[model samples]
Target: MEQKLKLWFTEHQTEDYGITFRVNHVYESEQTEFQRLEMVETDEFGTMLLLDGMVMTTDRDEFVYHEMVAHVPLFTHPNPKSVLVVGGGDGGVIREVLKHPSVEKAVLVEIDGKVIEYSKKYLPNIAGGLDDARVEVIVGDGFMHIAEAVNEYDVIMVDSTEPVGPAVNLFTKGFYSGISKALKEDGIFVAQSDNPWFTPELIRDVQRDVKEIFPITKLYIANVPTYPSGLWTFTIGSKKHDPLAVAPERFHEIETKYYTPELHTAAFALPKFVKDLTI
Candidate 1:
């Protein structure tokens, strides 16, 4: 006699947030179409999508993650003409960048064409902007693309996974330097740092590495439910402009869900612990 497997889910409440983590699921389907990813649904978090059985993002609170990741740096930059997005196969970052009127061209450099296709089908809301004429989607290694591109972009956004598997190289100092070389003199680069609660070491290392390449670097935080620890950080590196110095008048025109001019300013206001780690 063979044993039947079971799946269980647990939910917890924290101050103003609610989280639901799942464990043990029965075998459903084994389909490797594009990116070898899995899509599942949860009672609390809505839909849960996983690439190679690893959790990507959940439906219930994906907006918080996507919005903050894309808007903060785009809003801070006064005029971002040519923008490049690395590893954002889901197109969430592209969607946010298109919201800015000053943006002329947005390019998406994704390693897996399948991730983009899957997101476009299963996650329409997140992948909606890829169809825009302003967006030019490129399927290839973003690191190699950055190395080859010289002074090609005004803003670069790295919406990648954690430091693991193929994404490991993206976090290296060499890659940061290449990103610096790829950007226009006044361009800004922003990448998703790890969660402050679970991966502070990663955050510290990335902050240190980026500081060596760019004149000004800053760390900011956003709350996202699907990610480990539910709190994530984004590290911004700039050559000429400071993210903290956004003009007050610009705030009136920008529309955002989570990141506001006030929040954008406050996001850089990290606590003593985070500040110590980066500095």
Candidate 2:
């Protein structure tokens, strides 16, 4: 009798702990100019995209992060005609932004062209919106894009990965100030702050810095199993609009799996430990 061996993939979140996955196959593995990229098939999460050994997205739970990042700010602002998406080459966030009829143009700036190229081929459903008439894909630096623009965007979503490698500068105070300069008077911007359990200081620093630039700053949470911690946080900074005070009429029918009008406020209700980071 012969025994079959199982193949597994593990992401070390910390020195002591990590999450492991059962990989059925590796579809693509290559070294891009910016980072190491890999797309693998898994039984639990379907197709998974990894950058520098970190899980970027998976077929199973992408909607949660994309919807929460896009819809919350879009609905908060009275009108979001121009949207800037920083680092979301996977195109999930752009797909959600286009759902709002008011969005006339959506620009995506990703430093890595390989992420955009391979994602479109491997994760078609998630990356489908990049080819839409209203979208302009730029293979450039998001930080530089924000620095160059002046009062251009109505909504800006920083759909970046963890604050490391190419994304390290994206998490700095100067970048948030640059975002403030890039946005229109009533513009709203959201950035994914790392998980509270693992990186509470990062969230606290982001909240502190964004609060100084934008009058309305809030924190929200979402559940993403493949990420470092099951719980993830997003920091939102608005020049004038308050996400918590979105009007009932502003909420419109949109195709979504995890985000809803009711859950909009609920997502902001953070656990005590997580809420402590905001102050």
Per-model lDDT? 0.79, 0.95
Could you give me the TM-score of model 1 versus the true structure? Answer: 0.88
- Please, what are the lDDT tens digits per residue for candidate 1 over residues 94-141? 988888888899999998777777778767888899999999999999
Could you tell me which residue pairs clash in candidate 1?
A: none
Candidate 2 differs from the real structure by a C-alpha RMSD in angstroms, to one decimal, of 1.5
True-vs-predicted CA distance for residue 80, candidate 2, Å: 0.4
Q: What is the TM-score of each predicted model, taking all chains together?
A: 0.88, 0.98
lDDT score, candidate 1, position 60: 69
Worst 10 residues of 2 by lDDT: 1-10
The TM-score measured for candidate 2 stands at 0.98
